[model samples]
Target: MAVVGGGIGGLAAALALSRAGHDVRVFEQARAVSEVGAGIQLAPNATRVLRDLGVLAEIERVAVRPEVFEFRRWDDGRLLSSTPLGAAIEQTYGAPYLHVHRADLVRVLAGAFPAERVAVGRRCVGAVRRPDGAEVRFADGSGTAADVVVGADGIHSAVRASLFGARAARFTGYVAYRGLVPAQRVAGLGLGRRSTVDLGPGAHLVHYFVAAGRLLNVVCVLEESSWTREAWTDPGDPAELRAAFTGWHPTVRGVVEALDHPLKWALFDREPLPEWGAGAVTLVGDACHPMLPYAAQGAGQAVEDAAALAACLTGASAADVPAALARYAELRLPRTTRVQGMSRDNGTRFHLPDGPDQLARDEVMAAAFGLSPDIDWLYGHPVPASSSGGREGARRG
Candidate 1:
């Protein structure tokens, strides 16, 4: 198997496949496999898959287990809803809810695989499906063939373009300003202990502890006239960020004030694909189903895809590769489509202004404080038993 893209999703896919007794290699375009940015939430759905890959302990070492997710009003910092996580979520889902540096999680996943298995600066330019196997050509004019090819190269995937032709990603009319603040600089703000979101009209700010609670990861999203380029490393002006959320809660303001260098990116998502893969090649993560960040499951779903793909290919004959991939897609497509819909809907729900509908939303949130009713379906539900390791293909076929 050959996996493209060395980001979180790609690495996770590689880990799952290698652990399932497949000889897997990762082709990363960058000189080295890495992830930038501050924090990413590892909900139980993702953590459960991580545990199977044997990196839960290492992730836990650098991750902070937040006890709750505090949703509050942007203007006054009034609590709208408090959802208990940590032990409660773990007990229910059999995996812990954690916040870790995005880079840290990527490192742990990459480290799980042998160093020789990953190829750097090997950009995949095109692919050709041969009868014996599928082959991918790289920018260096070199090629590699595999029994299966996975396009986990993310939203702007080259393999996807070669396989499915060109498709534009919907430009979500929002820009996200993200940064990490040292815990010491933002001390006594009552922040860094729990994950918090300040929801307001047309804008919201989310903050949580990462790097073992020593750094606070902040992601502030807002609707603005200028749409940032769809790049994560786009630089952001703190002044503009401060002006946008000028009248927000003191806590939110404090976080903004502590920001040394903030970066921004235009948010983008794709409608679920009609087909994830065909023939001996398949897609995973953002390459297949890119969802908004509202649900915080984009990465989680990718991890899930990795597990499912590994499960289907385990102990399969060469003739069974295509069927195995199709089974992985069959089991994954419906769920990812549903999640994309939910995340899109939640994006609208999160930024509603103070009005009758907003009031009703507040009331409902207040009533359900300390418990996210949706967690049962989102976190506690079983994810196709990807851990069974390759038996699913035969059983389902």
Candidate 2:
């Protein structure tokens, strides 16, 4: 198997497949397979999958387990709702909720996978479905053929374009600014080990601890009328960010003040594809279903995709490769489509202007605080099991 793109999802796929006794290689475009300085939230749904992958111990070493997820009003700093997450979530879901720096997670995943199997600096230009199997063409005048090819490349996926033409991602009229600061700098604000979101009209702010409580990850998203550059490393103006959240709560203001260098990006997501792949090739993660960050399940769903793909292909013959890929898609599509919609809807709900509708929403949130059934379907669910029996695949040999 050949996996394209070495981001979190791609590496996770490669690791899972290799662990299942398949010879897998990863093609990464970057010279180094490291992520940027952002934080990722791993709900139980994600941690369960990670635990099964046998890397949860290493991940826990660098991850901070948040005690709770608290939502508050942006202006007055009133707690709207609180969801217990530390031990309570683990007891219910059989996994911990964690916050880890993106780069640290990538390092851990890459370390678990063999170094020689990952080919960096190899950019995938396109892919084709050959009679025997599939082939991935690279920009370096090279190619790799495999019994199955997985496209875990992100939103601008070249393999996806090669299979299903390029489509423009719909802009969500929102821009996000992210920054990381030492936790000590914000200690005066009394922020603890919790995932907090401050909701206001037309914008929201989220902050939590990462890197084992040494660093704080701050993200602010606001409605933008015009800007549409979808790059993640674009420079953002702290002054502009501060001005946008001028009347926000003091805690939010303090986080903004501690920002040293913030990166900004416009939020965009594609409509779910009718079908993820064709023949011996399939797509995973953002390549198949990109969603807004409002729900914080982007990475989690990708990890879930990795697990399901590996499960479906665990013991399939070369002739069964296409069927295995389809089974993976069938197991993942509905859930990812639902999550994509949930993330999109949360964008609207979080940015509602203070009025009757907002008041009603707040009332509901306040009443249903703590382990509400509303999210049980999301965080409480496990990866769908593959129905394939214990037949060894000829391709694995």
Candidate 3:
């Protein structure tokens, strides 16, 4: 099997398939495989897969196990909902919820993946359909063939485009600015032990400690109708960011003011596809389902996709590859689409202005206080592995 664009999804997919006893190769666009300084959440739904792959132990060295997840009102910093996440949640879900620096997590995953099978500096331009097998063409005028192809490439996936033609992502009219602050610099923000978010009209801010609680990751998302920038390379002005969230809680302001430099990118979303894989070629991660950060499940869902894909491909015969890919899509599409839809709904509630709706939201939060079942389904779910590694094509190295 060959996987394209060795980002988080691709790496995880390769690792899953490799462990499932499949010979896997990964092609990454960059010359080196590394993740940026941002932080990512690993809910139980995702941690289960990483644990099975034997990658979470390394990540645990640098990950922060937050005590709780708190949602606060934007203006006054009043707690709307505070859900316990440490022991009780862990005991209930069979895995811990963690916050880890992206680089550390990537390093941990790369350590587990077979290094020789990973080729860097290979940008996949598109896909190829040949008589015998599936293939991918790289920008370097070379190509490789494999019995199966997985497009773990991200939102602008070349494989997806090659399969379905070019399609533009619709802007969500929102922009998110993310930055990291040294834990020492902001020692008094009073958010020391939890993943917290302040929600309000037209904007929201999330912050949590990462790197063993040595650094704080802050991300602020706000509505922006006039601005239309689309890529991660788009630079941000600190003044504009501060201005957008003006009059927010003082601590929230402090998190923003502490940004020596930050990355700001416009948010975009794709409607859930009726299908994500066809024949021997399949898609995973953001390539098939891209969701807003509202649910904090972008990485989690991608991990799930990789696991499910590997599971479906397990124990299939050479001629059964297409049916396996189709089964993979059938198993994943409904869940990912439901998540995509739920996340889309989250934008509305997270950005509720000071109105009756906000009041009702606050009331709902108050009722839950420290134990909101609102996310029980999300936190309680785990991706199960397929135990079918003994079929016709299972003898491959």
C-alpha RMSD for every candidate: 2.8, 1.8, 1.7
The Cα local distance difference test for each model comes to: 0.85, 0.89, 0.85
Show where candidate 1 strays beyond 4 Å: 226-232, 370-373, 383-397
Among residues 3 or more apart in sequence or in different chains, the pairs in candidate 1 whose N, CA or C atoms overlap within 3 Å are 311-390
Which ten residues in a row are the worst by lDDT in model 2? 388-397
Best by TM-score: 2
lDDT of 2 by residue, 220-301 (tens): 9988886645464589998998998898889889998898688987888898998889999999999999979888998999
What TM-score does structure 2 among the candidates reach?
0.97
Please state the error at residue 240 of candidate 2 in Å: 0.6
Candidate 1 per-residue lDDT over residues 72-146, each given as its tens digit: 998888998988887887887899999999899999988889999899999998677889669888998889988
Model 2 vs truth, CA RMSD: 1.8
TM-score of 3: 0.96
